[model samples]
Target: MAWFDEVAKFNTPQLRLAHITDCHLFCDIDGEYFAVNTAKHFSSALTHMAQQPLDAVIFGGDLTQDHSFESYLLFAQLIADSPLTCPVFWVPGNHDEISLMQRISGGQIKSAKRLIASGFDILLVNSKGPTPAGWVSEQHINELSEVLAASQQPAVVFCHHNPLPINGYLDKHMLENGPQLLNVLHNSGLVNHLFHGHVHNDYQFKFRSVDILSTPASSVQFTKHSIDWQQQNMGASYRLITLERLNTAEPLCVKSELIWLNE
Candidate 1:
């Protein structure tokens, strides 16, 4: 069945979503990445998310570390077994396979890229590239522009790569055509915010008027500007975001908070 076959309505005044990223799951159930148990941390994230009354959940990207199909299956199984009833919108990271992700999506994890919730249009961008670096093609930019041109509603875009540079070691892996993306958003005048994952740590900045946020990884986080992983006690984290309009005559308001897991 298609993801949008049965469209659901969000009657609430506000729409809330939990954004988790960089799960980096392995094929082996007990496998560990950099001494961190990816599966256990992801499971913990799911458990925590299930407790919240969320409208949706966004899996930011980097769903696997070893690029194994079984790892994707493990990711699907974990979501299916979780108590979260909200839809999961996802994008592919550099480490993920497009075909495998599509195959497992459409249930808890939806395959749809465009979402309409609470009077806002949430669009997902695919920034995955052939290499570790991110790239957004001209076609994608054009499509996004066309969509924005046709819609007067507020927009929130989600993607796997950071469109702006952080001036660190990870900058090489950022979106190659970030300036083009910013150009579109700058011209659209409808996009209020942009959220992404690839950085492995929390980041906040502004490109013109758009507020950009990067979520921390659910498995392990990399130290900023470090060439190697310096083992420390950086735990898994996720972002909780709420979108609402105080009045019919006003612009949309966005509020976000970063939550860190004790595990």
Candidate 2:
């Protein structure tokens, strides 16, 4: 981990990361488990990723079923097997334990982290609260402001919630301080894209010129633009985040693949 200084420069020229979210991995495949067979799905993803040249694994959130200690252990073990010597940073979700997770996974896994990669700064913010309808604390917001203030280059911000109101119904369930977050991002003008989870559907949109990309669930698929998605089949999928230096531009052009299992 001493190489953190060297690796932060994005000296790789180009980089790739895998974004997987809401795996809800459980030890059991059945027995009213969180989502039966999520572990199997993750195993397939790990194996597939091993064959790729990805640099890192970025977990969006909701990595477990009940935020249990056992589930976190299982997650750590599974990630350890991934073909990654690079960094794999994770933010907290409603289904994850911030306290127990830090005890097991080394240090405190906070709501977010600001990462520098591929000559770009990536900011991760926590969007989960006491419930699925998420919220961010004022303290977290102030800290993120500082993170964004440090650099004036395009960065990718990831969280468990999307900032836009989905059809404007039940918008309260979305990011409580989404406008505030967007205000900062807009002011900075360095935020090129925003990636998020918790919606369970793969979506793409633009937020004040910033691309809003929401990947499909790592263990399920939901109806597009639906309010209540109960009958959706829980298919396994992930995103291959690619940061490309297009024609040698200042800000990296980002592209991603929606890799799906059990199609």
Candidate 3:
């Protein structure tokens, strides 16, 4: 219960979540990143996400491209204007400011690290490092181990950075101590999936038994496996994930798909 908030759990059999990430919004409402209007796309994503009923929304980070407090305000404002009623759990990306984000989180927007919904334990992990790369400190790993041990429910880990090399331009910024984090997840045997952002592309693969998935940016689309910064015309996209009980012995079955907008 240390990491989980004191919110009531959903009594439903399935948990559905909308994972939106890498908005890279700026302080200015009309700001653009690589000629893509981040605020506009983010607003569009919110509108699209609001159309569906979800248990929660995982804002996977890179919330601010300008690193201004006003950028965070704009993010909160967009959510406030949307029809999303479920809890929004967020983590920080390399370009984000934790202090600024904390100032803007309240009400439906939360800073809670863990959530219990639909028979699963969802954990939010901060993989932000000093550089653009990611790091999972021993302290955080220890905390994660303790949290997983405390619960018998199947676990899902959410972080801002991918813990493994994606073989893309963003691979250089993959989590530095990724193996350590994977070790914890592998050892736990309770973790079913590891979700993250920052790759700016839709990616999925498995590390041993655990599923590792990345959500695309709500702002710009990045070409996968490109050595340089390459843009694609695919437009903004987000991931929708559903977790359901299979049986007492089998882990929660994960079903995911990408929702594209303004293409």
Question: Quick one: best TM-score, which candidate?
Answer: 3
Q: 1 or 2: which has the higher lDDT? A: 1
Distance (Å) between predicted and true CA of 104, model 1? Answer: 0.2
Q: Please give the RMSD to the true structure for each candidate, in Å.
A: 2.5, 4.0, 1.9
lDDT of 3 at 137: 77
Q: How far is 228's C-alpha from truth in model 2 (Å)?
A: 3.0
Residue range with the least summed lDDT across 10 consecutive positions in model 2? 1-10
Could you tell me which 10 consecutive residues in candidate 3 have the lowest summed lDDT?
1-10
Q: Regarding TM-score, does 2 or 3 come out ahead?
A: 3
- lDDT string, candidate 2, 4-96, tens digits: 122234565567888878878664533133344677677677777767787767788888875556777777777676554555667677677
Q: Which pairs of residues clash in candidate 1, taking residues 3 or more apart in a chain or in different chains?
A: none
- Writing each residue's lDDT as its tens digit, candidate 3 over 107-194 gives 9988788776656778888798889999977777888888788887788889999998888788889999987898789889898689
Taken over the whole model, the C-alpha lDDT of each candidate is 0.85, 0.69, 0.86
